[model samples]
Target: MLLPARTLRFCVATAAAAIAVTVGLTGCGSDDDSGSATGTTATASTTTAASATTGSGQAAGATPSVEELQTTLAILSDPAKTTQDKVAIVVDGEKRATNIESMTKALAGYGTLKFVVSDVKVTGDTATAQVVISSPNGDAPPMPLTWQQVGGKWKLSDASTCVLLGFAQAPCTP
Candidate 1:
């Protein structure tokens, strides 16, 4: 239940794509549910840009700021954390709490999920980052992942989570 039914070819979705439309979900390559971003645009105030820095004293394209690294750490947290807390670090978290839980458990035995973030772009509340993810299984190719600012805090976008869940070939369709 780590990845969605689609080979995780579904794994490399862009948050830019999710921000531009309503994302849809499906079963992970197995039982855990994750999804894809498709269809129309959203109604929220939207802004898109590739920034060199988020102005928090950290350059977006250079060394990842403390905030950015923190986000990456949240994604790789100990599996013992509550699903609610885990979900809190990702966009649309409440809706995908179950899938998050399933994926968390599935990877618990594998050890931590590791990542490196670079080439980051910040647009208003949404940011796109080039990321290389590694799990106990191995390292996945470098990819673009979207991040969102919700309630004044940054969280991994749902679309990005969908792709990440595939880190170990687990089915995460939502």
Candidate 2:
């Protein structure tokens, strides 16, 4: 599961590899906001979704509804979504078109992943989502994902997206 040390930077090689494998291993799970899948429902409590406040240059957006985060995250983890579809969903995804394609290919046949959003916090326009990847296979420990408010919508952050791309051996730098 270990990749060459030189292949790692912001995402350690082993962790990156585990992510790719984790995506493939999960069955189906459901979050209160996201759609239903076949895996075990998360044990964590889902807070009531808050109305979103648009984030600007240095202002932080309010805690988004679980619906918003689930909606955006569903697209990010769905391998079947097109590159263009993904491009529009991630922060700075416009420029990471090629990198996105690489990840899509790497994750192809893994099917859609399910998740539970355990927590969310926004600092300025950037935010972090604590989530657990779920599947019929099992549930991963909670992991933090980055996000950003672009224009007015929440998009997965470029750094996190690139880490995903890295698992596919795509040459991307966050």
Candidate 3:
């Protein structure tokens, strides 16, 4: 039996959204050699400071408004925006490497993904947001994310337990 077009679209959108969340949470690694290079402490410190300051600056530039972040989340959550043509810019501009592949897999019936933002904290131009994501069968634990404001916009910066889950090996940088 053929499902309604709307139903098919809903399934696709839900799958895509799930992939975006998973990839956004666990992708990318900084190329800095601080951990391996001896006597690179100074460089590591500088890098950390720079990243922190950039986040702070971005959070500060928005007139203390959560509107931008909220709007971004809303747009991303929309099913209609799941198309590659529509989401390519967001994925590429944000440097979300894992999202595309994960999204494709999710669309192919891997599972469902859903999320909700519970809180947000902004200091200067940097902000941290807390979000919880759930899986399709409702068997997996909810993934918690710590999002950071960068370049005047919020992006997923860290996941508390992604490595443990084996979804990704590296943490997001920037």
- The top-ranked prediction according to lDDT is 2
**How far is 17's C-alpha from truth in model 2 (Å)?**
4.5
| lDDT, residue 99, model 3 | 49
| Residue-wise C-alpha lDDT for candidate 3, range 1-174, written one tens digit per residue | 233778745644454455456555432434443442111000000011222334444423333234444344434333334444323324233344354334333333222334444445444544444344443333223233333444455543433222212342233344
lDDT of 2 by residue, 4-71 (tens): 45653333544555666665443342334344332222333344334443344333455555567776
Query: lDDT of all predictions, in order shown?
Result: 0.52, 0.62, 0.37
Task: Rank all candidate structures by their TM-score, best first, as comma-separated numbers.
Answer: 2, 1, 3
| TM-scores of all predicted structures | 0.58, 0.66, 0.38
- Per candidate, the number of residue pairs that clash is 22, 6, 10
TM-score, candidate 3, is 0.38
Q: Pick the candidate with the highest TM-score.
A: 2
Predict model 2's lDDT versus the native. Answer: 0.62
Task: Give the better candidate number (1 or 3) by TM-score.
Answer: 1
* Per-residue accuracy of model 1 over 97-116 as CA lDDT, tens digit each: 76777766655533444556
Runs in model 3 deviating more than 4 A are 1-99, 139-144, 158-174
